[model samples]
Target: MSTTWSAPGRVTLIGDHTDYNAGLSLPFGLDRRTSVTVRRADEPILRVRSDSPGAGPVSVPARVLELPEPPAVDGWAAYPIGMAWALAQAVPGAIGPFEATVTSDVPVGIGVSSSAALEMAVGTALAELFGLDLGPAELAAAGQRAENVAVGAPTGILDQTAVMFARRDHGVLIDFADLARRAVPLGLAAAGLGVLIIDSGTRHEHGTGGYGQRRAECAEATSVLGLTSLRELGVDDLDRVRPRLAPNVFRRVRHVVTENARTARVTELLDAGRAAEIGDLLTASHASMRDDFENSVPAIDAAVAAAVDAGALGARLFGGGFGGACLALVPTDRAEQLAAAITAGVVAGGHPDPVIRLAAAADGPRREPDPG
Candidate 1:
């Protein structure tokens, strides 16, 4: 029998580093996604293949049911392998002989959670293949476990959750503290606007050193301030603790505190149908990420500035932005213009031409592709 499953990519409209700190995040699913096809096998072996260029197939014995001490490869296969390890942990005898063909339109290394999409796709496929009664949240958590523990990446739950539960034409407002979520309506089209993701195509490794360093730094700051996580700190708390932190930790904490507030404000604007105000928040969030969080690279900053100059409502480097993508909120009528501007700017900044596309707010993981 043929089993086909897909998982959507994610964009964090606001609240970046706060997820692991137990703060709220607002993210939306993108039209871009990764799909996986699988079938049961007679032998007790797990095999995976990717259609993407330079990626090859891999096979592992089912009898070897544990995660690699350190993952065997640093690329696409790590996701599926991590998922299998996670499933084996959750459900004894759940991972068995199977073969999977993976394919995705979600651009890799673009800070769009392409890796999570792949992991979720595989996790869902295995769940279906084995008749496991996994709920959306459970599936997301499983995928996240694979990333965080198995793959050793310190990522928050936002990417997996957004891919699993976001609804079309809306953003998911996630209370990271409680895992409570509400799909906030966005009227971009109704307001004659579009969301543009400009892929810088610069791949950075979240698992390779940088991500772990940042996580450790954030954790150290929280510990020093006597808070449970960075999320517990408010503006006043930041002011009170600012003098004690190193200059860099102070900046990082500043971004997290202010970014959390910005997410709440953006949610309000979305609920009130004030589409025009979104750009301002987007720009502010980008500035905070760039200056305070120290995430933005020169290429990312250039793309954001170019999009705004080309009449985007607001633009910012999105995701874990050392190198990845930038997003722009533009009038739908001017989407092409904004996209072109961002593309040209990236090229002018000595990078390759960026991939530009219009992304609608899309639903999270579903059994069937969204109707229309």
Candidate 2:
């Protein structure tokens, strides 16, 4: 028998670079997802194939899973292979050679966190196939390890945690200081509010130097501030530290500090059923990313401006930034109209035609019922 599993991509509604600094983040699982099908292989080799265009089949000795990282595998296949290594580490002897087919509607490199979705899908399949008793958070950690160690991307737990702990009609509010997660009721659909994701058609990879440089700057700031992480200070502490940090480092530090507060406020607003009031905070978060964090790209900025001008309640660039998707909160009735306006506005600004998706809070990862 074969098991098919899937995990949802995530949208970091607010709080971007703050995760690694042990700050707060609020993310919702997107309806877009990645799925994996797994069954035992006849040989002692881990085989893989993907339906994504231009991806080729990869095969490697199953014993490589025992290593800290699989050096033989690279590219998209490394995500699942790395996940298998992580799962094995969590529960020794729980994984073996398997052949899997991967598929997804989760667009890659557009900031929806398709990598986490892919990892979680493969992790869920391995756990079920081997009967491992891991919970959502544990699985999430393993996914993070896979990315950080196996895939070599220095990402925080936000993507994996958001993908695994997500709830329908709710967003996951995570405190990286302690990895505590609270389910905040989105109440968007009930309030006739919808989040429109406009793909700026500009791609970015977390493994790239730009992302690493941002992380490095945050670390330097943290060391200079004499704190372990930026979470050690609150917004009130920013003024006291500003004079000590370089202008650039200070801005980076400022973004993480203020973003945490914004994330907390948005969580409170959503918890109190004030989802409509979050537009200003979303826009503010974007401004912080653009000016302080220096993560927003010109195309994404154009898309965000168009979204706001087209009557979006509030709009901002979502994901790891640099270049990715922009999220705009809009009335459910006007979602398509807003999308059209964003498209026109983006083209007028001389950027590529953007891909627009209408999304809502969605369920987390799970094993799919066998279709056989």
Candidate 3:
């Protein structure tokens, strides 16, 4: 038997560095996705391969029940390997011998949650192949398990939740405190605006980057502030807490508190049909990510600057922000010029060629038809 599963990569419009603090985030899945095609194997072995973002392909041989500890593999192999371990735990007796080919356009190392997409796709495909029951939420939890334990990243569930739950015409407003989410209508497309993702051409492996350090700082600040999480604090509470913690930790907490409010305001603006007013909030987010969180890169800044000047309604350095793409809200008619300007600016600033993708809100993971 053969089966294919697909899940879209996600982009965070605002609320960076807020997820781990139990704050709010606004993320939407894109049309681009990672798909895994699995076919039964006669040798009682499980194998995996991918054509994107890595040193090379991988082929692991093992029984579904006796899955080994996730090996420390090179490049993109760890994501699938880690995911396999998680899936086996979720559906031990249901899995059997199979080989998978992973294909994806959502570039890894650029912070679009490609790892989560791959994990979600693999989890869902394996469930379907073996007749195991798994819902999107369970699959998302499985995906997060892979990332945290096997892959060694302390990321929150924002990306996985967005991938599993968002609608085609909206962004999921996630309150990480309780895992309760509501879909906020993103009618930008209906308002003659388009969302664009421009890769700044730098790679960030979340496990070994500034991401961990920032998370550590937040945890430390939470202890010093006497709060359960940053979610307990608000923008108005920052001034009072500012003098209590170390300078850097205070700034990190500040980003979380204000960013949570920003996410809500972005939702309000989207609801009010005032897509253009979001530009300041987007730019402010970039500044906070740069100044307070100290996560922005020069390539991303250049891309955002050029895109906004070109015609975008708003643009911000998206995702985890050490080095990744920027998301821009632009006039649908001027997307080409906006992309061109970003490319030209990055090139002029002496960076690698940037990649630009235009996307709309997309549905969550689903089973693809059997191949013809």
Candidate 4:
């Protein structure tokens, strides 16, 4: 039997990089999605193909899927292969010899968690095809393992969990401390507000790059603070901890501490249906990322300023730092005008014109009806 599964990409509104610190984060699944179709194979091999441009097909031996190490495959194929490997470890049997095809509308390289979307899609399809009864949380954990172990990116569970537990018309408040999630009412549509994303087109990989460096720095901060995780340090404790850390390390700690607090405040605003008021908090979060966390790029920073100039209530750089996309909260009626203004402003600043789109909160991953 053949089956299809799909997962949505996610956008973090606040609390970037706080996931590994065991702090809080606010994220929502976007309308964009990645899908996978899987069917049993006659041969004992897993064959994977992608509709992405320039991506070639890959084949892996099903026998090696149970191994602890990731397969030798690289590029986009690693994500699916990693998922299979991860699922094999999680489930109590050998993984499938199946043929799978992948396609996505989720923009790549713009910090929308496209990788997580792909991973979840693959995981869901494999689970169903193999008759493995896995819950959403279990699937999310498998996806995280796929990224962290098989894919070699030291990422937190936020991306996987965000895309799995997200609810339509709501934002998810994830406490990395306990892996607890609460749905916050975004009410964006009810409030006449919408989310606008501007893709900076600058790409970043989570695998052993500056992303790893930041994670290492956070670990160092945790060690210096004598805490298990940075979540143990609240804003009140910052003054005492500041004297113990170096300048840069202290800034990183400060970002996590303040960001956790900001996430809580945003949650309160969202709970009260005050989505519009959370705009300032979004801008503040961007400032913290730019000045404290040191993750914002010049193009993203310029685009954010332009978005505000174009009447966005608040704007901030989205995803892990270095390069990605910027998000703005704007009036729904003015979305087109704001997008045009932000694009024009970015281009005028000598940066490549960004791709802008309006997105709404969307449901999480699930089995999809056959497109046929």
Candidate 5:
């Protein structure tokens, strides 16, 4: 018998790179998702097939007790394999051999957490097949463990929790300090605002690049400031501690502290239905990431400029930086024009033409009960 499940991808409305620092972030699941279909068998072999953009197919033994001491494989199949491995770790010996097919409309490597969407999709299938009884938070944690331990990506809980907990027409305000999530209302369409996601088309791999390094710098700043995390500092406190930190560490801490406040403001404004007022906050966020965090590339800046010039109310570089995508708050009427201008500008600036995706807030991970 086969069980099918799907999980949506995420877009960070505000708050960038603050998750690992145990700070605040606001994200929403977008309309795109990855779907997985799984069938359990008696054999010891596990097979994974996928149409996930760049991943090929793979097969491995479903041996929970004999998992490789080190993570052995990390291709397209790593996501599902890690899903089964997560189930194995959570409930010993309950994992069974399974065959699964994965497909996604979520663009890979665009900072949309395509990997997390894939993991949660497969994890939900495994949960149903084995009767694991995982809750929303448990499911998110399990997927994060799989991504971190098995996939070797040092990401925090933002992407996984956003995909699992976000809801329709809302942004999930996540406090990573304790994994608490609250779905805040976002009246974008009612307010005549549109979310524009412009893919910079520059590929970034979090594990091998500067993402981990930036995370480490934040930790260093926390150590020097005698705080457990950068979350402890507010925007006012940035000046008090600025002299004590090194230039780079101070900049990193500044970004996190300010971004956390921006998240709170965005949540407040979103709840109040003041969607247009949050545009400057979005642009400020991009500047912090660009100037303070030093993660934005030329293509990212170009996208933001073109988006704003084409009548976007506010545009910022989105994702974990080093080249991913940009988010713009635009008039619903100007969305197509914004897309066209951004594309032309990027290509004219000698960068690859960017693909623009218009997204609305979507519900979190969902599973269908087995009919058999």
Candidate 6:
């Protein structure tokens, strides 16, 4: 029997760097997704292949079963290997004797949570192939574990959770501390608007030093202020801790504090059906991330500027932002114009033509190959 699985990538609308701090986050599923097809084997070995030729076939012995240590092939196969290793812990004999092929449209390293999408797809495929009944939350957690332990990135749970559990056409407001979630209806696009993903084409690996440094800096700022997390701080509290922090730490804390407020405001705008008011907040968020968080690279800044110049309602650098992608809120009619302008700007800035796409919010992961 053949088992096919798919999971969507995620976009964080607000509350960046807050999940790990036991705070709230707002993430929505994207239209782009990854799919995996798997079949059972009897030899107790894992065989994997991908559509991309550079990512050659990889065969891992079931005896090894160690994550992050899969045979060093390259590209997308690492994602499946990592997922299998992580899933093995949940279902002791589940990972062995499987052959899988993976394919995806979620652009990697663009902060769209492509890694999490791949992990969820692989995990779901394995569960179907093995006749294991795993819940959506458990699957998301497993994917998060794979990314953290197997991929060596200490990321928060927002990306994985959103991809696995959010609903279509809604933004998931997640309380990370309590794991409570509410699906807030955000019919922004239905109101003659669309969310544009402007791929800067400047890759950012969360597993690398850049992301690690930001996490550490945020933690350091929290420690210096005697707060458990940056989430504990507010705009009013900045004055009290400003003297204790280095300039950079102070700036980082400022962004988090302000960003938390912005998230609340944006949510309110959506709830009130005042989508136009969010434009200013989006621009301010990008500015803070660039000037204070120091995450926006030149390409990202250019893309945001170009989108705004091209008549976008709002534009901001989305995701981790060291160098990935940005989001532009444009009228549905002007989406093409904004995309072309952003592409031209990137070319002018001596970068590759950005991959621009209009992304509609979508549902999270669910069981597909049910064995009835």
Write model 3 residue lDDT over 1-372, tens digit each, in one string.
Answer: 789989999888788778889988999888888999988878866677887655465666664345456656556777777777777788776677778888888787788888888888888888888777888788788889889878888888788888988689788988889988888888887788888888888888788869999999999998987779989997888888888999999889888888888889998998898777888899888888888999999999888888877778788988887998898888888888888888998889888889997888888888898777
Tens-digit lDDT string for candidate 2 (167-204)? 88899999999998899999998889999998988889
Candidate 2 segments whose C-alpha is farther than 4 A from its true place: none
Report the C-alpha displacement of residue 88, candidate 3, in angstroms.
2.2
**Model 4 ranges off by over 4 Å:** none
Candidate 4 residue-wise lDDT, 1-372, digit = tens: 789999999999899999999999999999999999999999999899999999889998988677778787788888898889889888757476999999899988889999999999998888888889899899999999988887788888899999999899989999998999988989899899999988998888888578888888999998877899998888999888888898998998899999999999999988998988999999999999999889889899989999998899999997987899999999999999999999899989999989888998999987889868
Ten-residue region with minimum lDDT total, candidate 3: 63-72
* RMSD after CA superposition, every candidate: 2.5, 1.1, 1.9, 1.0, 1.8, 2.6
Residue pairs with colliding backbones in model 5 are none
In candidate 1 the C-alpha lDDT for residue 233 amounts to 83
Candidate 5 lDDT score at position 168:
96
- Tell me how far the alpha carbon of residue 349 in candidate 4 is from the true structure, in angstroms, after superposition: 1.6
- Worst lDDT 10-window in candidate 2: 65-74
Clash pairs of candidate 6?
Answer: none
lDDT values, one for every candidate: 0.83, 0.90, 0.84, 0.90, 0.86, 0.81
State the displacement of the C-alpha of residue 323, model 3, in Å, after optimal TM-score superposition. 0.6
After superposing candidate 1, which stretches have Cα over 4 Å from the reference? 66-74, 368-372
Candidate 6 per-residue C-alpha lDDT over 1-372 given as tens digits, one digit per residue, 9 for 90 to 100: 868888999988777776776677788999988888888767877888888657778887766564444344345666787778777777776566788888778888899999988888888888877877788788888888778777778888888888887689899888776778888888786688889988888888887866788889989887777777777777899898899999998888888888888888888888888777788788888999999889889988988888888788788888877888899888988888778888998789888888899988888765455333
Flag regions of model 6 displaced more than 4 Å: 66-75, 366-372
Residue pairs whose backbone atoms clash in candidate 3: none
TM-score for model 6? 0.93
Q: Relative to the unseen true structure, what is the C-alpha lDDT of residue 131 in candidate 6, on a scale of 0 to 100?
A: 74
